[model samples]
Target: MTLQEIFALSPIMLAFGVHAQLSKTTQNSTSNVKEEDVEVIRIVESRIQRLSSGATGLGLDSYETPQSVSIVEDDTIANYQLDDINSLFEHVTGINIDRTETDRTYFNSRGFDITSMHVDGSGVPFGDIFVGDMDTAIYERVEFIRGSNGLITGLGNPSGTVNYVRKRPENDFAARVDLTYGRWAKMRAVADVSTPLTESGTWAARAVVVHQDKESWLNLYGNNRNVVYGVVDGQISDTVTVTVGYSFHDNNAEGNTWGAVPQIYSDGTQADFPASTTTAMNWTYWDTLNRNAFAEVSWFINDDLNFTSKLNHINYEEQSELFYTYWNTGLDRQTGLGLLGYPGKFSAKDDTLIWDNTLQGNFNTWGREHTFIVGVSLADAQTSDLDSAAMSGFDVMPAFAGWTGNEVSRPEWAAPTEAGFADIKLNRYYTAMQLSVSDRLDLVLGGSFIDYDNEGEAWGASTSTTEDGTSPYLGFTWEAIDNVNFYASYSDIYQPQYYLNEDIEPLGSAYGRSYEAGVKSRFENNFLISLALFRTEQENLYEFLGYDDGDGVDDEDYSDDFTYALYQGITVASNGFEVEVSGPLNDEWSLIGGLTVLNMRGENGSEARTHIPRRTFKLLADYAPQWNEKLNAGVSVRWQSEVYSETTGFGRITQDSYGLVGGYASYTFNQQLSLHVNVDNILDETYLGSVRSEQTFAGSPTDYSVTLRWDF
Candidate 1:
């Protein structure tokens, strides 16, 4: 059917009874009351089943057989008012979000970081903010599999996996548009449209675009993001389905306001300033880009037999331009500080391409039940960095001109003319599999092998690195009873830290391992509760205190030649327990909250980072009074616990780790339009969503926004 034909059949428009009203006035001789057909108003929400092609008992699960797994459905996505990819992560049962660096959000599961991300169970080349890329609008749901997805993810950190389930086309026409404006000129607009091209619903297509920009609450910094995406799905005969998709995202961040915590008073009191001051030093502009394209084909050999193939192509780039201004703890009449290090610039770029595929399925066997999945994959990940010396110098705390809010800082020195260059490449091939004995029992076994080559000129010297090794995996899961489940798994994982050494070549390592158990209750999919216990360990931890390269001359020149200072790195082991409950409390109220307590020991418990929070809590509550259905409003609040930062015995990065709350109210005017207003950090509390922990930066406050949406 054509678009116009579909529009004519819309139930929403028929409910107005306008056509019948005109007909009655023109030709009804029955002022005496005539029999008439009554139009029924019916609304059909998007079907949960139509959201994905298949299901594995729980919601949409990772078909590749995971050590332990879970899914976050689309309905959940809409429930939380999540606007971006990072926002949706809170839905994960055991995951925690941390801001370890500026704009670099770190998500951890089972005591380790999550470095792998997928698109419909396949890799998206550039997964996180590291590449300043991600546009979550095209996917229907996301599946997170903790522990060694190496069978499908190839080489990288094996701690956990994030798979963005891309949405395909159907015969029905669906479209939604949203526009929002936030504090400091933060504005965003997004549009999505999808439909089928063939009468039989054999061919379908979808397109999406998103644009957003916002001013920094930290003073001079501001950020902007743009995305464009498209996809095509075709049914090749009745047994095979083919899908191809492409996504592009560009992110530019200026006036980096890395946060800094004060050192005075132990209770933690935030001193107010002009807001533009970087605390001590925060002056840099960093930009990044990520582009991805992928193709997938699924074939059903019989009612119970199926095979799937996937190919992903990705391109990522990063750019940086910074000016450093030193802060001397000065009082502000102007920019508040003086210049120290010379104004300099540092830039790096990464290019990666991954080729992977999986052959997996389930076969009837055993008196009980059995399911198995296996796959093989490969990747070519490369990086290059270009740097420069001091170019200009200005007052670190210049005379004020209305603090732009962007942090400005200078570098202490520059790389020797020929040194500061890096070019490296790593190639890897991995094979893995998972087998489950029962609906509630699963076992995971996998392996990975990597070979890498790197060559670069950094610090006025040439260097090269060659390395190869294998990582193994093992895991098991069992449901203890009706409302409780327990799972324990282990996997040895690694990553290439590749970077320019004194010689300038890629040299890196990897780390990850976990023993986990969890209990989940899902009497109603809308109301989910879970508690997880995990023991995590990390290895290959490499930290360089920096060794002097022999460059002739005296002690000063003695620092020329890079000598050697290497210890396999510190090993950290952590035991933690987490509890969470989210979803509807009733028809008018819903909640999302969780808490985690961890006991971490690094370098065999010799020392603790003073500032890292050992315990953290996150809570969100939403209430919507029906008010007769047509009109409804919702209010939501969010909060977190005290967090820690490093201490130098002089000053510290303090994140008292307090609570933050935000509220949002939305109203539906009709079937096609809605308006929403949100005040994030309604208390306007001065706090950090995350911390980087240094004299350089910390995080800033809550902001507000309003959004309007139209759907058909």
Candidate 2:
């Protein structure tokens, strides 16, 4: 079906039971519509399991929260083979994944970059340039909140927040193993086991191990990854519990590109490169390692009160030998002689520590029962980097035409230098209350106070800053009907800037506010539907003014290193809407999908972030046949509107609208064994992987994989 038709018919089908098959699930068996039957259907409770805390830290389900939220469950992840963060987010509503290079990726939502991230309600330090490819084997599910989350995150942009929920040990004994083989000589193995460690079943432990080695469809590209995780859960008393865990991940990649292919030729014509094209040499490699340790304690003060505390520590290291190729004079269509090569060796290390504590309880107020939550969090992080450049000679490649990856000899590197260093600290105090004003109306009020400090040297300059601010949050939900709710919310955004002015002083922070309103409805059999409209306004965002001259400013003495580009603040606004639906249609079929529309403009009313698509749609559907009893199948579709980017001297480069299709199927021979198959890019659609900059990469082509599973 077309995008327009799908959007038009979704609400009608959901509200009035227009579809013949859906009617059976939406209404009772009786043909006649009675008032009592309508009321019975409206009050039907949800049977779906709920998370401890998701969008608001209130332990509320999607229909109860006053914001836009989406979830990717474990079943969906396994069926689609979403092994990595990039593949997992592609299925989320209103999320766009930009693969700028082989090993680097960026995400965008609501016309802004998504920078806020958490693991089990605790914030983590993350950036596109620093974090490596994240594996999802250790996670049970991923929760998404599609708007400003400053109330809980302390300080951040108005984009969105992502939280990953880890898999924990269960009281019962269970074990599973999987072996997979796929195209391009890919091989993978995974083992997971969980069991009760004590006779009383009050203590449990779980362990998981994974290993994968895969060759890319791109020439001269491959990688190997390994992961290990272990966790222990113990109940010290009837009202107290404790948990501890540790995880390690290592990945090594060869022939990874630093950037992507050039977009334009010397003649101002667009360049066309095959999906299998690569600009990396055989000797170049990128390797990364990560370790995490965490501990948690939960105490139930009484039936009406509870408290929880958590601590986490993380260490990360990276080493790489990379070669970057760019066209200084633009590429010539006939000769391809303008390529310039920059080879470098680099290493970096980072350490982070985080602590969070929360208290939640119920109280009787105004003849009604209300809920409140208060929390505090602390985060400390430090990082250092070393960089080495190639010798003065050997800066230009011989030719690009008919060139092989082994053509260039490894260049000699100079002495390593301290390229960057940073130390950051943050402390946050926050509280929120859910007031049960009446039987149908509920109000939520909360805010956060943050103290932040940073000291670092980067981008050939020195930096030091200290700032503090308060961000407030307000919202309300009205149960207009038994199973339907209307809600609205307001949130503040505060983000500090690291850029410096001509005077070598750090620029201040950017401030903003976000407003959102939506309607949510729950149906029988755990189906849910939501529609939201949102707007955000931000000011004091840094805007590059030009580089300063060598002369001193106002006749004052200044060093050469301080002559960097100056910047000023600017304002921008973003407005958007989203429609999402999820849950099972009946016993045989289930589906999840969404549609997003956005518009972003600068103060002058011109388009901002034009490279991001304004409209996108994603959907996934699964089916299980009753006759077969052991057969299952699924399909997925993703479509995006046209997007374009403007280069300094090359004008505009555009990527037209495109769509991709994928499918999967599985069969069980018995309770202990099963076979599964998956296919990506089923129609072999060719498109650009990323178009947010002048350098662009081609998307993946058709691929397939098969797996065998055993359960005990």
Candidate 3:
């Protein structure tokens, strides 16, 4: 019912529905849409619409792009009410999300999970363990450019790239505020505001702030976070535009409680860790702080030329560790005894500087079409930290409710803080340029060259320096059917060098290549759909393990000394197909969905390195019914196929896969205010988002959150 209709009835009746159940109700009915598939018109933001006066292939020569690409539009964000990195990412095809205690965010795309993030064509830094540590408030649209960016961003994985575009100042002032409450005591508040700084509308400023806290399915694990972001844009003249932005975020966690402990008992029978065992080991909680700033400018040289440049800086500091990792101290797998696992105090800091510049040109020949783009990129980052630890030879384990920041006294260990920390520093740079040609006939040709270098030093037994090279990209796109676009692209990627291990041996550099094909289409601005097939090969892979340096010292010394180094550049490859559909099917209803299937394997089970995964899948869907202009309700579901990775010592480990479902209904009584509630993980699906065999740590559990939002 419309808000007005419900209001006219009885306030008591509306109150009763407000307290109704928030559960997912499946729809088994088949789609009534015509059998003949129709292309979905894209309702994407202006930045990604690819405007062109002629039949010239959209602004950028995507047909000639060396790698794969995906775009998440503004409509997607507004419809899903995405106010964070995870929600924005969930809508992108091939992307996966795993929330660890609500403190950290982990994701996997293609086949690699520990991805390097980038924003506005610049590389963004990640936490020590390779988790994204950036605020999403400063972003308006997200562009995913797959493949090697040797010609664009310089250094990145061949799997793909994620580029976040900060929200730009419009010609007028605008703002949005949202409040939400969901199951599990979840409460969230967010505000985004922008306005012109001058009557001429040449200067503009915008800001976004968010604060949220919630519990998890796990016993003692949960999350709390606060983020602030601001940006300013100035038009120097009719031909010039400049932009500056910054963001600060703090992620405070209750526990790092890695995944569940292995299923084992005193007699070897699979037994659960007591449904109440939430805290993994003794980790109480940890906190991390991150900040970033950047400046960008664009110049319109002439009728057919434009130049753009951006410089970015990022910093991160970790105060405490969520949990102390415990591994099998003995190589013998039979004991199953966890060694040295508990909560450890730690501190770390990281700083990064990245820059990117691009030039775009438009020209005409023989009444045909030609668009060109040339760009270069570079980045440097370093991180290090120290920590203290204490272990009880054999102590009684504690339950989730009983776990706290209090430390345990050990008779054998005094001033356990004596366990120092590892100090590390690293630096790297990448440069690339590309030129493309396109014909109105739906054909494009392009070529690019890339150069990269890496050098770094680390204390605590390791220091090294290295460099590498890469050159490979071929692509093609053809309109097979009336509105169907078929595309194929190949690219080669490379990375800078880093330390090998505790010995400081240099692993030199790493490189790889990718092959992909897909077909995509846009509907009448309501939604979009696409399908892709891909495969990738990586060389010069890095390997880590416990090595006996032939010294009388025990494995403890070796484990501490052994780090990682390049062996022979193991040949690792992955192939898969992905399908994505998003947009409203009708006036009253809208939907979004995707699916992925991966097949990746190593050659001859090479010990040097192992293939990422044999097969995996990711799916997402959302349906919202307008139910009259003043009232709306909808549900969203995201799912990922199981994951499997092999270990040099352990044969194969399987990561269970699962799905997460959420629903929301909102009512706006007036133009200035509204109330809404959402239910996440409606089914409470159980699954692991990540796993570290060596550390014996898994991701957090499935839970729900209830939120209340408001705007003026």
The TM-score leader among the candidates is 2
Global lDDT of each model?
0.53, 0.77, 0.51
Give the better candidate number (1 or 2) by TM-score.
2
Per-residue alpha-carbon lDDT of candidate 3 for residues 34-60, written as tens digits (9 for 90 to 100): 323111111011112323211111244
Candidate 2 lDDT tens digits, 1-712: 5222432454322111000011122323323546444322211110112244656666667888898888888779888888888888888889988777888878878986787778877875335333456788888789888887876687646778888877877657888898989999989898989897876566778898999999997787898999999988665554456677889999889988887677777777877888888778888899999898777766656546667777777888999988777665677888877877767789999888777778877889689988788888878778898888777324576665445678666778888898778888888899888899899999988888988888887655776789999888899999998989999999888887776665656777889999999999999998999999999999987655545543555322211222355777778899999999999988888888899999999999998777888999989899999999899999998999998877778777888999989979999999999999999999999888888766767888998999999989
Error of 2 at 44 (Å): 27
Give the best candidate by lDDT: 2
Per-candidate total of colliding backbone pairs: 46, 0, 30
Which of the two, 1 or 3, has more TM-score? 3
Candidate number with the higher lDDT (2 or 3): 2
lDDT, candidate 1, 1-712, per-residue tens: 4222432464222111000011112213223333331101000111122222111111223222223455655544544456666666654545666653445676766555566666665453223334343556667777666544444444435456777777666457889998888778978898889886765455678898989887765655677889888887665544455667788888888765333322222223323343344432445667877778666665544433345555555666766655533233323333323323334455665555444444444455566434444444445445555656553443344443334433343545556233343444444454433455777776655666666555655454454567776666565556556644555545555565543343333345656665556666654545767666767676654434344544433352221223332223557777767777766788877766667676767775853433345666666566677766654444444444565554333244456656556566778889999888776556766654454333334334666778888999
In candidate 1 the C-alpha lDDT for residue 678 amounts to 70
